[model samples]
Target: ELKVEQNPLFLSMQEGKNYTIYCNYSTTSDRLYWYRQDPGKSLESLFVLLSNGAVKQEGRLMASLDTKARLSTLHITAAVHDLSATYFCAVGGLTGGGNKLTFGTGTQLKVEL
Candidate 1:
């Protein structure tokens, strides 16, 4: 089986709310990343965590990585309708090519207006 997993396959939240999506991996990896996708659209890069305790944020979304724990987190702050989309976390080794990505099943986020 793939090494990555995500919780809450589907989630619905009201506008201006906060929530968090968790990602867990089964093996050691050099990096963890988060991505966002809209219906019928391609994935957009959200975060790239290279080391443990690495945290990055943009707009209402924040992502953190812990290599030792083999986990990642994406936190949403004050979500808006525009934030309604699917989120995915991918893991890979540092030396491996992009082809090494193991993507999670994805979490669907719906924000009511």
Candidate 2:
């Protein structure tokens, strides 16, 4: 079975700060995805890491994957109020029939001014 563990379940930071969220998986995975969700909204895809050492960045968020270590990281640079949301990392692995995704508990970020 594939299990994912994410650190810093809750993060409170000031605007213009930087932080990183980590995701560790128990088994090998084919793909990794990062998602963000607001208080009352559905999840929004942030980034997708296709291969080992793959990195993607948009705006203030950056995501990277290390398939060799079964790890993924989401980095936030110059965080702002609009970046406050719950972030999730999902890993896709080959199961019995098809690939399945297992999500982490999530890291809640609160950016303050």
Candidate 3:
């Protein structure tokens, strides 16, 4: 069975702070993805790491994947109130035709003034 776990299920961050979220998986997977969702909003794709040593970043968030260790990381830099939202990491496995993804419980981030 493949499972994904994220630490710090809830985070309270002040404006202009930095934090990192960790994700660990139970089995081998073909891809890893990071997404952000604001209250009452759909998920927004942040990064997709396909293989080992894959790293991608946008704005104030960075994501990296390690296929061998079955781990992924999302680092937030200089977070703002706008960045306050729930973050999730998902792992995808190769199925017959389409890929199946298993998501983490999610980490809610609150950026205070």
**Model 2, which residues run further than 4 Å from truth?**
95-98
Q: Which of the two, 1 or 3, has more lDDT? A: 3
The TM-score measured for candidate 3 stands at 0.95
- TM-score ranking of the models: 3, 2, 1
What TM-score does candidate 2 get on C-alpha atoms? 0.94
Q: Which is the leading candidate under TM-score?
A: 3
The digit string of per-residue lDDT tens for model 2 on 1-113 reads 77999999999999999999999999877599999999999999999888999999999999999999999999999999999999999998777997678899999999998
Worst 10 residues of 1 by lDDT: 92-101
In model 1, which regions exceed 4 Å deviation?
Answer: 94-99
Q: Could you tell me the lDDT of residue 27 within candidate 2? A: 86
Model 3, 1-113: lDDT tens digits are: 88799988999988888999999999988599999999999999889899899999888989999888888999999988888899999999888998888999999999998
lDDT scores for all predictions? 0.90, 0.93, 0.91
What value does the lDDT take at residue 89 in candidate 2?
95
lDDT score, candidate 1: 0.90
RMSD each, Å: 1.7, 1.2, 0.9
lDDT of 1 by residue, 32-100 (tens): 889999999999998888888999989999999888888899999999999999999999754445547
